[model samples]
Structures are given as C-alpha cells and as structure tokens.
Target chain A: MKRYLKICMAAMIISGLLLSGCGKKEKQDPDSTSQSGVMKVGMVSDLGGVMDQSFNESAWEGLLRAQNELGIKIGYLESNNNSDYGPNLESLTDAGNSLIWSIGFMMGDAALEAAKANPEQKYGIVDMAYGNNTPPNLISVLFKSEQASFLVGYIAGRMTKTNKVGFIGGIKGFIIDSFDYGFHAGVNYANADVKILRQYVESFSDAAKGKSIANQMYQQGADIVFHASGPVGDGVIEAAKEKSKWAIGVDKDQNSLAPDNVLTSAIKRVDNAIFNIVSDLQKGKFAGGATVVYGLKEGGVDIAPSSDKHVPKEILSEVAELKTKIIRKEIVIPYNAKTYEKFYIAKQ
Target chain B: MSIKAKLTNWSNSAKRYLDNTFVFTLIAIFIGLITGAIILAFAGFNPFESYWAMAVGIFSKPKYIIYTIIKATPIIITGYSVAFAFRTGLFNIGAEGQFIVGGIVAALAGYFLHLPPVIHAMVAFALAVGAAAAWGAAAGYLKARFGVHEVISTIMLNWIALYLSNYLVMSPAVKRAESEATHKILATARIDLFGVWKVSEQGMAWRMENRFFHDLLKPDINIGIIVAILLGVMIFLILKKTTLGYELRAVGFNKDAAENGGINVNRSFMSSMAIAGGLAGAAGALQVLGVSLECVNLSNMEGYGFDGIAVALIGGNTPAGCFLSGLLFGALKYGGGKLQSMMGAPREIISIVIGTILFFTAMPKLIRYFTSRINQKREEK
Candidate 1:
C-alpha cells in the first residue's frame, strides 16, 4: 500500500510539473486580436530550403522587406521534399497568415490544390503558370527568364574564341527548358556556326558535379559556359576561373562570386515581383486570379552588368539591341523546346 | 517441484524476458521524453504545449491519423528488414539500396504492365520484391564467397542503386513527358486507398456510390498499412513456429556451432540477407505504389532505410515491436510538422529528440541501474 501510494504521488508531481511547463509569460496578448490592421505574410520554400541563394532566397528577401517597411508579420517554412508543399502551405494558412507566397514551379500542383481547398485564402506562386482555370484566390506569377538568358547567350556566342560554348542546367523542367531553348535561339542568332553543348546535373545543390561538368566543357574547347543550376552555378564560376573561361550565372547577379571570370548573369527579379505584389496588397489592390507575366519590358528580367573590355563593344551593343527587339516582340525567342524549331527554321 | 514452485518458475522466466529488453526500452523512452522537454524549455518554447500539440495533432484529426499510418507503412517494413537481419546476426545497412532497387522495379512494373486491376498491382509489387531480393542476395553472396563484410558491400550497393535509379529515371524510355518523374502507372496498377479498384468503369461507379463508406474508413488510409501489419505478424509467426527460423536463430546464436551441427551457415547468411532485402523491397514497393506514385524523383536518399535502423533498435529487434515502434516514429514525424507550425520551432529538433531516444534505448545499463534503485527503495520502505 505504501509503495503504491508513493508511485501515485510521484506520478501526480510529474504531471503537475509537466502541466505547469505550458505556462505563458510573453505571448504578446494573443497575436491576431492586437495586430488586426497589420498583414500576416507567409512564404513556403522549395526543396532547396530557405538559403539556396536563388529563387527561394530572393523571395525571402522580399518577405523581409515587407516586414521591415510595411510593418507586417512574416513567417517562412522550408520544404525538404515535394510532398511538404501542401502541408507547409496548409500550416501557414492554419496560422492565419493573410497572404502566402510559394516559390518555384514545383509548387504548382500543391498550391493549386490548397487554393482550391481554401478559396478565401490568398496565394501567389512564382514561376508556375496557371492557364485559364486558376482559382479565384490564387495568382500565378511568371518570369520571361528566356529574355534574360538570350542576352547572356548572345554574349557567350560572340565571346567564345573557339566558336564553342556550353550550357549547364540543374534539372530538365519547363523553367530550365526555357533557359536552354532561349540560349539556343540566341546562339543561332549570333553565330549559326558556333557549337553549343548542354548538360544537366539533375540537382540544384550539387556544386561538385557542376564544377566537373563545367571543367569538362571548358577543356573540350568551350570558352564560355552559362548555368541555370542555382548554387551549382557557383561551381561553374569556380571552373571558369580555373580554366580562364567565362561563366554566366542565373536568377541573380553572381559576378561577385568571381568578379573576373563571370561574364554576366541572367537576372530574374523575383524579389521585385514579390515586393510589388505585397506592396499592391497593402494599397488595397490585391491582384488575384490572374497570371502576371514579368518580362523584359517590365524590367523583370535582364542581363547583369558586364564590362565592354571583357565582351567586345560591338557584340555588347548588338546584344543590347537584341534585348530591345525581344521586348518589342520583333524577334520572338522560343521559350520551350516545341517553339524552338520554328525559330531555328526562320533563322536558317 | 510443487505447483506453486512451477508457477513461480514460469513467472521468473517471464520477468527475465521483460528485464532483458522491455523494461530498458520503457525507461529509455521516459528519459528521452524528459530530455526533449528540457531542450524545449531551454529553447523558450512551451514543452507541454509542443508535446500536447504533437499528440493531439496526430490523433485529433482522422486525416492526420491516416497520414501517420501512411508514413509508418514503409518504415515498418524497412524496420522489419533491419530487425530480421539483426536476428540473423547481420547488420543490414544495405536496406536503403535494396529499397531503391525495389522502388525502381515497382515503378517500371507499374508503368509497363498491362494486367487487370488487382493482378497488376500485385504483380508489380511481387516483381519489385524479387528484384530487391536479388539485390540483397548479391551482397550476401559476396559476404559468403569472399568474406566481404556485409556492411561495406551494402553501403557500396546503396550508392550503385542510387546512381542506377537516377540514370534509369532520366533515360528517354522511362522519363515522363516534361517532368522528372516517370509516367504515372495505369489506374489498374495503383494500390489506392481502401483497396478501391481504380480502373474499371463499374468499379469507379461503385466507389463513387460508396462515398459514405469511404469517409467512414477515411479515404486517405491506404493498403500499405494493412500489408505492413500483416507482414509483421507473418514474420513473427515464421520466426516462432518454423524449423527454418529455428535454424536461423541457431546460426545467429553461434555460427560455428550451427555449422558443426550440420546447418549450412553460408546458406543461412545468404537466405537471411535475401529475406531482409525482400522486406525492404516491400517497403519500397509500397512507397511507390501507394505514396509517391513514382520513384519520387529523389536526388538523395529517401531516409526510410536509415530511419528503419532506429525503429529496429528501439523495437528491440522484434516483429511486433517493430510495428509499434514504426508507428511511434511515424507519429513523431507527422506530428513534428504540426508542432513546428504550432510552436514556431524548427522541425530539426524532432530529429534531435529521436536521436536522443535511440541513444537512451541503446544503453540497457541505465535502465538496470534505475530499476534496481527503485526496487531497493521499495524493499527499504
């Protein structure tokens, strides 16, 4: 009887301690009621996590800006796999975030499903093109990344002394396919005789594989290599430095990684798009249920600054003119593999 | 001896079994939970709230419970793979590689085969299991033939399987149109939720009409969990009630003795590894057939095999224990996601807690010391 009583007492004490552990000291008077006017923004990252220095990172920068300038509360969840997209978005919604941003095309299905499930919640996804049947609360934001890739490709085509250049892609998806096709069109536009080699490392984070592939391309007479492989592009720049070749980056300006070897970057302004969307939302102009295309005309995509001394003055001017022509729709560069044939046939 | 003495002897034996593993495991779990609470407190999060949220998160919603079960299905099989190998005195770190091979085979079979509804899914799963068995047996053969440690062979095999799967998935023949995954299998081949036939028009009509039944059963609950639990029971029966299992245990107890006693030790090693591989393959098959619906486009290890090791260790290498431990781990994983959103803590802390649990579970001395102290105090009182 004594032993049983002792055990019961111990159990009671433990439960008491455990229950007290939930004591709240600094919860800020229940977040939703106090911050009625302030907006709550949530961001979901792709498989590359929050710090990939690419699309996810750029989107996070936009969220941070909104928090600092607009006085909005922000939270982010990083996904380790594709399956996490739906759950992460749902979690953010459950947290009562008014607006959510999903980064990358891989999130299209998950975001679409979530948007369908919760028609009242507002969502904006980057790089995912929703045709005509998009949910009323979800907005799809697309970037004409090819417009930027074209300028960099033209530079590569003209700068290659051996008449050979290369392109390295992270994965064989629609977005990467756009970069590849646009680069092909640009190379053909510059010099049809130049050879372009392509390789996919099949991952966004494999820097070593990126370096090896870039090195091999450089060794095989390719003087310039452009990569759309996120962090893998850093390795490409590293290879370019070692081999005295030029490397073109993607998503953002990466010339700082290797100032001398990096020719330019195919810059896609994801941060600008995100900031503009949230800013518009703040101003009571929440543009939902529409596909917003950020193209060259909108300054959504561009070639980063590269010195004329590195790229020939004539080639630079020609590339700049080509960019204007593309913006004007005078030269419609192919954004996908199927459309590339028509462009190629016209060039021939 | 009298009847009382005989009853006491039986109770003593039962107590011995509990002392050997069960008590230690329970104590370990208690310590691990307490440590996790302390860590949460140190991190300025409400430990009770986080744990309560995790518990309620996994059980409060029917969908969450189904999700937990779904998550457990594959790991349960993989845990069995590890547990079965351990019982045979082999460390099967190669479950990961074997699972990948099995997953790839299942994907291929699911895509290419044109059989009827039930037959197609079963055939695909069986083919996957066979392929994974072959992969596992190859490592075992190497260990038997050239004295290569199963550990090294399995690790190397895992890398080979990863690269091989990657190459195959990327090939033009297998690669899906404009996507990283392969083409989705025919509806006939899918092991859909509730064992519902997904192909025939009649089956579709029936399933649509039975929406109430589906809801009652929880539409998200798939056949994988059923298969995992059934396999666990069958494995337990096999180990306890069969001559083959008896021989296998003998080999595990003393390989040289088993060999001298006319049991082929080399054959046991090969067969045990093969069976272990088959279990892992079942996990892979269930994952592709039921969960991801493709090879899942993994750029790195999917972690089921590695998690299996933890499940097996915590389970004390028993079939029934593996099933329960698998569920526990799965609950942690499923609930961890909710905990992160609820408490705003990093999900990595869940992994740390899991690791701490495994650490405590591995140390039987800690449990023995505590239990002995408790017993001494009770006697003194």
Candidate 2:
C-alpha cells in the first residue's frame, strides 16, 4: 500500500509539472507579440462576466470597438470569484498583451502588482485609480455618471405625465449615492411640482427586487422611472413592462431592451471612454499621469436618442435643450437626487 | 498469491484512484465542461471551439502556467486551514476574516520593516499568522468554555473580522491619510522574483547577463508552493501516525466518545481553531511575501475563505485531499479565464461548474453510480 501510494503521488507530481511546463512553453512563442495595430488589449472583469450588461458589457463593447477599428487582438478574463483577481491579471500580462483593463474598484491592487511586475505593459483601471504614484503605465478611467444621471433627472422631471417619478439604485455605497444625488438634482432642476420615489436593492444582481421596487413606484403614481442598478436594472424594465409604465435607463443604452416603456437612458459611455483610451494607446497618445474624467464635454456621457415611438416630441426637444445647456457650461447639474430634492421634495 | 492476499491486493490497487480527489476533480472538469458547452451552445456559441480556445490560451502560454500556480498557492493554504477545523469537528467560516486581518497586518509589516527580503518577509508573515490564530482562538474559547455553537460563533467572527479589517485600513493603524491604502511595503518584504515579466533592470540584466534565476527555476512559482506541498505531506503523516493526530481524529469521529475515553475534546476544539486560523493567516502572509509584494486592500472577503470551504468539501476534509482540491480549483480558474477570453465562454462558467460538482459530491448515492461503474470495470478486468 505504501509503495503504491508513493507511485501515485509521484505520478501526480510529474503530471502537474508536465502540465504547467507545457503551458509555459506555449506562452513564450514569438508569434503572439505585436505592435501598433497588432497590439493586444486584455481585460479582467470584476466579479461579473462580460455579458453583465452594465460595466463589463460596456467595457467589452469598448474593447470590441478597438478590435474593429484598430485591429487590436482583444481578450479578457472574467473573474468568477475574488481570489482569481491576481492570477487573472498575471495571465493577461504573461500573454504579452500591451495593455490590460480591469473594471471595478477591487482590481486596483491586483492591477498594481501586475503593472509592477510587468513595467513594460500599460494598464487601465475603471471605477478607481490604480497603483501607487510611481507606475507610469497605468491610467484611471473615472466617470461622472453623476453628470449624466443629473441630466437624465431633468428629462424625467419634465416628462413625467403623472407628476411622479422614481429612481432605483443598486448598492448604497458612496458611488451609487453620488448617482442618486445627481439624479435628484436634475429632476429638481427641471420641475418643482414633480413627485419622486427612490429605493436601493443593495445588490447589483437582484433584478427581482429591482422589479418589486419599480412596481411600488408605479403603483404610487410614478410615470417615469430611472434605474442605475447594473444587471438588476433588467428587473426594473421587466416591472415597467408588467405594469405598462415609463422608465429611464443608465450605464449603456438600455432603451432597446424595453423599447415600449423606456423613455430615455443616461448613457455612462464606458464603451466610448475605453475605446478612446485604447485608440490613444495605439496612436502613441496614451496619457498615464492623470485621471480622465469623461463628462458631457468629451461626449463620454450622453442620453441615447429616444428611439421609442412613444416619447413626446416636446419632451425630446426639451431634453436636447437641456443637453446643450449642460454641455455649454451653462448648467452644472447638482448630484444627489435624495438631498437635492429635500427642499423641493416631490411625492404624491 | 493466496486468495485472501490477492483479494486484498486487488481491492487496494482498485480503491486508490476512485478514492483520490484529483480523479474526482477531473471527472468534475469534464462534467463542468459538458454543462458549460450545453449552456453555451444554447446561447449561440460553439462549445467545442470555445473550450479549444481556452485550452490554447491557458496552456499555449508559459505565463498562464505560472499565473495558475501562483493562484494555487493561497487556495492550498486556505484549504488546509479549513480542512484542519473539520478534522476537529469544528466548522470554521471565519478563515476569511483571519485572512483579511492577517493580510492587513502583513501589509503594515511590509511597509514599516527595514530588513533583508527573507527575514522581512518571515517576520511580517509570522505576525499575520499569529493574529489570525488569536482571532480563531476567541471563537474556540467561546465554544469550548461555554458550549456556544462553533458554527454560529465562527460565522459572526467572519463579520467581525471583515469590519475590523475595514476599520484597520480606514484608521491610522493602516490608513495612508490622503491615500486610502498605506504606503507600499519596503522593497525587502516583497517577492522580487519574476518568471516572465521582470520589472527590475538588474534582475533582467542578471537573467540576460548570466541566466541566474532562470538557470534554477521560474521565479513566478515562488517558494510558497514548496511550503504548501510540505504542509500537505505533513498533515497526512501527522493525522495518520501521531498520537495527537489519533486523538483529534477520535474527537472528530465522536466527540462524546472521545471525551469519555479520556481525551479532552474541548481542548482539541480550541487548538484546532487556533491552528486553522494560523494556516489561513499564513496564506494571507504568503500573498504579501510572495505575490502582492506587501500590498493588502480592504476587501470585504478575498473569496478564498469561501472557496476554502469548497476545497475542504471537495477534498473530503483531508489535508492531502485539500491540497489536491486546491490545485484542481486553481486549474479550473486558470483554464476558465483563458476559456472566457478566447472561447467567449461566460466567466460564470467556473461557478456553474463548481456548483455542479458540489451538488453531485453532496449526494453519495449519486456518486455511487460512477464509483460503482468503475468497480464493475475492475471486476470485468
């Protein structure tokens, strides 16, 4: 039994060594290297997968844009669990990708270590700035989704036929709080008499809870609703469809998902920002020393034109004017829908 | 051979592979692959092509291999941490907290210490392990002294550990003030070795100049792998051979019976938690000393603690089994990444696969179908 056990152990060790050995040999092949249009881009998604339809989807869309326009060989590893973060980033670096993108705040540390280990590789981190002060190969893509949410609130305030509007948010972190505040700030700016309801699901994945909250909003006379609940917003759309109510969308142009109910969407433009950064890298214009804030001015955030057949023409024209004002430095839309609306709280 | 000896030989050789966790893990991989393929195919992508692409991406590159092993290190340690608790009849969900606390402590040590790389790394790692073990002992004491349910206490401890870690980073103990994180650890505490991506000009120059690190081994794998594997062997030998190991196993098998037999079950319980926490803390320390290079963030849970439960279960709560399971999980994660990127497989495929394996593994009758089939094969042979 002892001899047999020894042989079994030896076999496993040999196989493990051989498997890892073979894996390493393949990574060293020169055919994988590239420059310019041949440059490769890699991403490590947060806990969510690429089709998360929020941050990951938008990021992948940006990479897809690079793949299409610049002919970059793009790849991404979705992190199913938290422990995989470091390894996922390392694999991308080891694969010799010139640039790697990591979404969400969690990847900040992992991305930093990977960048330190691979100084020649450029990295872009979303949601938060990554790395200590020294690494020159990192870029932070910070978005003022607050700005877009603020503008969308204006549209929601002006377009509400029932005098009541609602906002559904995912997670109550400072970031989401910013989204809430900016949204209410826009709505309050647009209409004083309008009623607004708010609820947070405390999760990015609970679409059912999103729908339930939207249902409550719809029942309480909210005609227009906006959701910044990541994939959970899919539930908001479902609730709208179930009740035949109006909804606003955010992150990506989610209007198409619920065309009958969606009035307009606050576009986060993550795809555009990602593509822009990658394109700059390809053109040797990659800026590493600062945070790039993509707001209304850079066309990094905008409302996707309401393609729905139901949007009132007057509301659309009014939103266009609001957009112009927002872009022209004429309007600095306040963030925080909750607090901004306190003096002018709108409810049934 | 005599009939009795031949029968025993036949059973011994045949029982080995079926009893091994890695073989089951491989079976799980195929099971996961098939399920993933079906779901993916239903979603309009070619399962075969996707799996092939994942294979090419993960295995076709040397970095993927190094990265996978790097990932395997923590899993192995956490697995032993969890498996140790189970062996003493305690369910420890607090490994996550212990890991986080240890990580934060190691991060601090990494930043302040000014020593040689090996010694600096060792001191920082030791502090982390001590913190984790101390934390675990709290729950053990509560359970052993007052008869509190370890399950409930450990669960609560996990939350305490999380909030405590969050506080550490937010407070001056670890806070960088203007920066959310503390300053980067001094260079001595970092794992300076590089396998494929060397940041140091001297390291690269040394490699190019004399092929030093390369002449012996790849840098990315690290010395931690050896520590993890050694622990696996040690755990196996100690549990099978030592008197203390026997007492612990006896307590695990039947606490009341062991207590009646003159073994102090309560003492064993407390010791078990301390040891478990130490292992998890060690895992966290190794990350700073081996991979993270002295950086630890305020993560709610590093996911290793949760996955450690899966490793313990997959390994059937044995040390060697946990090690093998850890490696298996590492492979799944490594391959899963390459799979997602190249084959367009959803990243959630890894979870789906693990979930499926867990579901089946939980049902012995369900497993019996396969093991029985293997037995039939042996009979025919």
TM-score of each: 0.86, 0.67
Chain B TM-score for all candidates, comma-separated: 0.87, 0.83
lDDT of 2 by residue, A1-348 (tens): 334446656856764675566556655444645533388889988865688778889999999988998888888887755446776786677566878998876576677666655557788888775334736888888777777887778778877889899989876655577678888877878887787798876556657778899999999999889998787899899899889998888888787888888877888788888999988888889887467788888988877766345666787777778778778967665455444555345331
Q: Considering every candidate listed, which one attains the maximal TM-score?
A: 1
TM-score, model 1 to reference: 0.86
lDDT of 2 by residue, B219-249 (tens): 3456778878877887777778988789888
Clashes of each: 0, 12
- Which parts of model 1 have CA positions greater than 4 angstroms off? A1-16, A20-38, A185-194, A201-208, A305-332, A337-348, B1-20, B37-49, B194-220, B365-381
Cα lDDT of candidate 1 equals 0.82
lDDT per residue (tens digit) for residues A1-348 in model 1: 224335545865886676655434323434654377878888888887777767788888888888898888787887876556866787677667788999988788779867765667899999997888787899889998888888888888777789999999988888898899989888878888899999998777678889999999998999889999887887899999998888988887787788889888888888888988998988888778899999899878888765454677897888888878987899998989888998888777
Identify the leading candidate in terms of DockQ. 1
